[model samples]
Target: MHFVTGGAFHGKAKWVMKTYSASRNMEGWFNLYEAECPETDQFETSLVVLEGMEQLVKKVVQENKKGTREVLQKKLQSWLEWESDVRGRRLVLIGTDIGKGIVPMEEENRRWRDVSGWFFQDTAMAAERVNIVWYGLEQTIK
Candidate 1:
């Protein structure tokens, strides 16, 4: 797994496209901003790019406050296992960094921020490569 995180409107998406778009067998991007949330069985390409994970975390938190972390962790594990199950398969996750700056006043917003941060930490730990993109620059952190 390759994990990339940075502030919104940073160069994360551009970097991802430039770095991985050469592969002809790569899957159509599963962007949470546009499509329905994807399941493990839905991925069927050599390289899988998943964008807008922070949104998913927010959705999970909103719908299942009691089980948000568990649900996401399970989903993450399933994705990781799926990637490992197939040789030459790759998983790239792109998430906007939402844990920075002034804390939100709303309870739900604060919860979303905390859960998203924790989820990102878990992703970074499992990822083979971790990067932070800022000001159109890429910096590998792990």
Candidate 2:
């Protein structure tokens, strides 16, 4: 798995497409918001791109009935496990860096930021290679 992340509009998507030699095909690219993550199945091909994971984390944090960090953590744990267990799936995950910049004034926003930071760390640790794009430049972390 390759984890790519950076600030919004920082060229993460462009870097990912170029790095993976991906074309503009619906079969290879996926928007996580359009699909139900909990019910998503294993990929059959060599590469699969799952974009907008930051939004998914926020959505799960907002939608979880318990509205607790533990619930969000558990859900993310299951989702990441599912991704790791898939056979022959080379996943390119694109997420935004939400923990930086100003601290949120709202409690929920702060919680989301905190949870997203933790989730990203866990995902990065699982990834075989991780990269952060800054001003369209790529820097490898692993």
Candidate 3:
């Protein structure tokens, strides 16, 4: 698994697309911004690019208030297992760096930030490669 993160509009998606030469017409490119994550059986491409994970994390945190981390972890583990199930198959996750800057006053917003941070941390730990993009530049962190 590869994890890529950066501030909104920092070119994370552009970097990923260029790095992987990915396109929407590709068989297995799943950008969460456009559609939902596909099930393992439905995954039909060698590479899967998953964007907008922070929003998914926010949804999970909001819907499963008591088990947000557990649920996200489970989903991560499932994706990792699927990636490992076949040689050459890869999972590329792109998330916005929403945890930085000023903290939100709303309780729900704060919770979203906190959970998204933890979720991103978990993904970075599990990922074989981690990167941060700034101003359209890529820097490998893991």
- In order of appearance, the predictions have TM-scores of 0.94, 0.81, 0.94
Residue range 38-63, candidate 2, lDDT tens digits: 33354555577878877778887787
- Candidate 3 backbone clash number: 0
Between candidates 2 and 3, the TM-score winner: 3
Query: Which of the predicted structures, 1 or 3, would earn the higher lDDT when compared with the native?
Result: 3
- Across 87-135, the per-residue lDDT of candidate 3 in tens digits comes to 9999999999898899999988999999999999999999999999999
- RMSD of every prediction: 2.0, 2.8, 1.2
The superposed Cα distance between candidate 3 and the true structure at residue 92, in angstroms, equals: 0.2
Tell me the number of clashing residue pairs for each predicted model.
0, 0, 0
lDDT scores in order = 0.89, 0.77, 0.89
Worst 10 contiguous positions by lDDT, candidate 1:
21-30
Which ranges of candidate 2 are over 4 A from the true structure? 33-38, 42-44, 65-87
lDDT by residue for model 1 over 16-114, one digit each (tens)? 989986432346578888766798788877788888999999899999868788899998999899999989988899999999999999999999999
Among all windows of 10 consecutive residues in model 2, the one with the lowest summed lDDT is: 36-45
